[model samples]
Target: MFWFQEGLCCLPTFLVVWSSSTFIVNYLIALFRRDVDVVFPYISDTGASPPESCIFGLMSTITAFAGFATMFARYKYLQRLNEITGGVSPALNKAALFFAITSCVGMCFVATFQETAIRIVHDIGAFIFFLSGVVYIILQTIISHKAHPYGTSKRVCYIRTIFAVVAFLAAFPTIICAFFVKETRLHWNPEDKEYTPHLASAVSEWIVSFTFVFFFFTYIQEFKQFTLKVNTELLEFK
Candidate 1:
């Protein structure tokens, strides 16, 4: 059972652990180096400087690749399930896959372009990641509902719907409040006028990131029931 899809959980688990660890490590490093505020810094803020930035870039790149694998596996799994169930929404599945892939590409951009280096490009990447990621989960929730109690369970569908809703709730504020802050300061003071908006946006970003990790965690159980297979055919040359 080498191809037993239960092992697919490792990809998401790796993503969750690796990304979370990357955040925590960078946060501590930036805090200790006095490179960022003690209160709360944007994840990118923690990775803006030298030593920590190196770690952040390397880890985030790997995280992005892992994300790609996880999404592709899920896409193939659903496609196979739909075939077996005679489902009518292949287009929906394809749409979900597209958004997921696009989000991963955004993650690469986030990793490559530091906010301090090219602020606009970095922000564009973050925007794409958050927006596409939220849409992907929402679409997946819809797909789960469409699958019903046959291909998937009511409980799983409800859980995914909740995660999707939470992600949307968080992502909106993360993007909106970010625009209100006029300056990007590594060390933020509580009394600063932009502090409130900055805090709101940073907190929202963390919430969205953690929600994405948990949402991927939910895929573990569902993945256990299936298997992935690749077939090769040799053709005669004329």
Candidate 2:
């Protein structure tokens, strides 16, 4: 039997692939072109209104869709938890759902107001996305510990716990570097033989982004039971 839930759950995977691919491809090209700041340039900078702005914009659009799908998936996951925990889902599950939704909205806002046209709104959206993402991961780590109605394996939960911790740790520094780092200027020293900026927020930002996306790997176990409902009508979500 076909399962809409399985498809829905996989939306995050699609998000990971599409968004990552767009950045990786553009960043590689940008590296050779070196037209942008490279390190300081936000991901949205890849979509600056010129030759490849359209390309990056396309990626942002894809990310927004992925974020929307992820929000829906989180809602469904929370509902599943409610069923599993005897109609009393953990508070964390519901809270995570809300944060996930906020992150989705942030993604859409960033895409709609790309930095070139509206820098402040874009910055605000990026902050929302990153901060809410950390909160969502922390909540999910708590949720994964409960004995899920879907019989998600303990092993899977442990894996999630590990990833969640790493992701949260990674995300905080990204925000710190973005906001508080006073040294944005590049530094050169023959002692270290490295020409780099004192504040390399981009490095931390990429780590946060990749780790956050990887954190979604935890949901694979939760999606198993969505396979059982043979009723097609139920799949319609009506």
Candidate 3:
């Protein structure tokens, strides 16, 4: 039974982990491109140092592709879940769709554009993802409390609610920090004119990073709760 339960959850977790890993790898590769100096001579002055050409660009491209694949997987997963559950809430479904679209767009843009633009869009995408995650968890909590046959105790419901709230609150500071961080720049002309979309990109990255960390911890707790519930159900059956 544990095997069956894990099999059911494994695909989604794998998709998320793979997508995230690709993204990080790509970001690291872009950080060290040799042509970075030629493209943005003034990068040093702005506190953005050029990195050695590495696998980041390739990784980033791979990440983009993986993200798109994950989006499709997520859609299919939700669709099947809806069928099993008699239908998901329209609002939650819509929100999930929004996040899926935004994240895909952001990843595509990051692959095609310069770092600054990519940073800005990525931040927006991250926020959408964070928002969607929160909504899904909340809606699930509500459904579990109201409908689950095992009967959710009031204490359990309250604890879940508090955890969700704390997770949501962490997003704000993360976003704010991302907005204020420095950005990578590229010079267009020989006049050494600087054009870096620093403020937004920096802040976005900071916020996304912080938010991801917070969500990671929150999700671990959520997973524990889910496992506990499943175990209890299985024991009762035994």
Among all candidates shown, the one with the greatest lDDT: 1
Candidate 1: tens digits of C-alpha lDDT, residues 34-69: 999887789999999998999899999998898888
RMSD, candidate 2, Å: 5.5
Stretches off by above 4 angstroms in model 2 are: 1-9, 37-41, 87-90, 148-151, 180-198, 227-238
lDDT of 3 by residue, 15-129 (tens): 4465465544434444454333333232111222233112333444555555444444444444544566644554565565565555555544444444443456545645555
As a TM-score, model 3 comes out at 0.46
* Model 3 stretches astray by more than 4 angstroms: 1-17, 23-54, 116-167, 181-238
TM-scores vs. true structure, each candidate: 0.92, 0.75, 0.46
lDDT of 2: 0.65
- Sort the predicted structures by TM-score, highest score first: 1, 2, 3
Q: Looking at model 2, which ten-residue stretch has the lowest summed lDDT?
A: 190-199
The order by descending lDDT is 1, 2, 3
1 or 2, greater by TM-score: 1
lDDT per residue as tens, model 2, 1-238: 4442454556666777777787787666655566455554556655555556666766777877776666566666566657756543556667887888888778777767866677778778888988888788777767666554344677777777887777677676666656653322222233432223223556667777777767765554455445223445545565
Model 2, residue 71: C-alpha shift (Å): 3.5
